[model samples]
Target chain A: DAGITQSPRHKVTETGTPVTLRCHQTENHRYMYWYRQDPGHGLRLIHYSYGVKDTDKGEVSDGYSVSRSKTEDFLLTLESATSSQTSVYFCAISESTGSYEQYFGPGTRLTVT
Target chain B: AQSVTQLDSQVPVFEEAPVELRCNYSSSVSVYLFWYVQYPNQGLQLLLKYLSGSTLVKGINGFEAEFNKSQTSFHLRKPSVHISDTAEYFCAVSEKAGGSYIPTFGRGTSLIVHP
Candidate 1:
């Protein structure tokens, strides 16, 4: 319960459409991450932000882009949704003062058809 | 770059039975290891992590893991598991620093505990 929440708990979009998933936090953590969970694949990082306006790519960041404009919000966008991008997306936050234990949001299930 | 391997794709056990899930990792530099659990229809939760110091790390739900640097292993273990312990367990590793702390996760092991 780190006060993390993901919007649009579920979504369905056609291929080649733009989709954005939102993550909001209230604990004011310094680090926020975006990850997608696939069957048998565990969780793979898509993007992460260490601070406001500072972000980096992850292993599966090929078609995903992320931006963090405020300390509490991190947004993940799919330029053009594809069938392969359909998965459960999770947002996690870590604090600079704690043991780096990541707290996750419930998740957002996106289906690209 | 770092990678993690979960040897068991699935494990089935009865209540009160001891269980162990094997994990192995590869990294050139010092790395941090972690175990995460994902219940049905939920996000992954950190079970435990090995940052520094102790090789043996205990996490919630009576779960523990031992980091063997020489063997490149951090296997998750429990003396006895309960029905509620059934979930998908993931082994992950991250660089100590420099690489944004983005973790690489294994394929995951599905643990099924029966009564």
Candidate 2:
């Protein structure tokens, strides 16, 4: 929705395969986040980047990794996909870290077989 | 650490009926409250937020929420809901920690409006 876009909106992959999701923002926001949405879990943060090359893990960082080599792009990688990792992923951007509303992008739905 | 709890997992109501979605949070320091709505196959959109001055906050689509400091709760309410109002609502809380704000979100409440 806001100038954010996620690539590969839908994908199906087998177990133990590597997958990467890309998030691109045209707003030039300083903060970007990766989150996963499951049936019971609303949205769990996987990783976040404060700036280019500055990344940190979130509550559900296990089995996932992230990289931000540029201000406009953030990448989420799954080294070995599992059935448990199948979920809808969303990317969000914020102008500030505190009290600022985070704008979300169109989600990417990934299914692991 | 901050955590948000949404009391209802799902609520069903008829058109033109009123609705209330409950939310509570636990935090050690001051916090900011927010409500977000997600329609089918869509990303979340901000409905309202309680930053500082007002305890009662009005948001888009005639929705409103009240922040209660004593009860540590922020509940969303609407007097008259339309069929188009059916969606999933999520509550979130953010607090400053280590010079950064970390937000914690609730599971979410699914609102089903029937004719």
Candidate 3:
């Protein structure tokens, strides 16, 4: 297991409210990623950071924003939560993107009512 | 760009039965392949990966996958399965693009082992 942790393992929020999910890693991996898992959709990347203060949008970065201030922490913020945004979010870290595999955190389940 | 395809959405089998999960991928250039398993309410765990070398790659928990470059497929297989093997399996392919390595994932295939 990797030294990865996701805060607020579970959360429930109403629609139109702002919510932020935090991912922290102790492995000091160079690459960090955020993904959402749905029933039919296995896993879709939300955003990822290659280095501190640097981030890029994933395929499903429509209403999500992420920030990485340091090497260990990556934050995903939903400006105004929506019911459709309710899903399980997972944070993963990889030493390098080339041929290395990713390590995943337990995951955070968010519900938007 | 790289993409993955899991041929089956769900496969049900009896415990101790042999099982195989199909995975196919498409990429313009040479790519890396990986297989991951996700249990209920848990995150994905790497089962195995094929970067280079021999086509047969062994992984954890009595699992293995054979990477076929000609077919562009990395299919996961297990000789005998237990009840604990019930989980969702995902196939992924990674390739370098725009100076960054990006991975594309397949919609998982649920493996249900019944007693």
Interface RMSD (C-alpha) of each candidate? 2.9, 0.9, 1.1
- lDDT agreement with native, every candidate: 0.91, 0.93, 0.93
Residue-level lDDT of model 2, residues B1-115, one tens digit each, is: 6678999999999999999999999875788888999999999999999999989999999999999998999999999999999999999888855523867889999999999
Model 3's CAPRI class is medium
Error of 2 at B10 (Å): 0.2
DockQ of 3: 0.78
Docking class of 2: medium
- Model 2 error, position A10 (Å): 0.2
Per residue, candidate 3 scores C-alpha lDDT tens digits across A1-113 of: 79999999999999999999999999999899999999898899999999999899999999999999999999999999999999999999999886889999999999999
Q: After aligning candidate 3 to the native by TM-score, how far in Å is the CA of A33 from where it should be? A: 0.4
Give the CA lDDT, 0 to 100, for residue B21 in model 2: 97
Give the Å error, residue B94, model 3.
0.4
Candidate 3 backbone collisions, by pair = none
Stretches > 4 Å off in candidate 2: B97-100
Query: Per-residue CA lDDT of candidate 3, range B1-115, in tens?
Result: 5678899999999999999999998776778889999998889999999998999999999999999988988999999999999999999888755423767789999999999
lDDT of 3 at A4: 96
Over A1-113, each residue of candidate 1 has an lDDT whose tens digit, in order, gives 68999999999999999999999999999999999988878788899899999998888999999999999999999999999999999999988512367888999999999
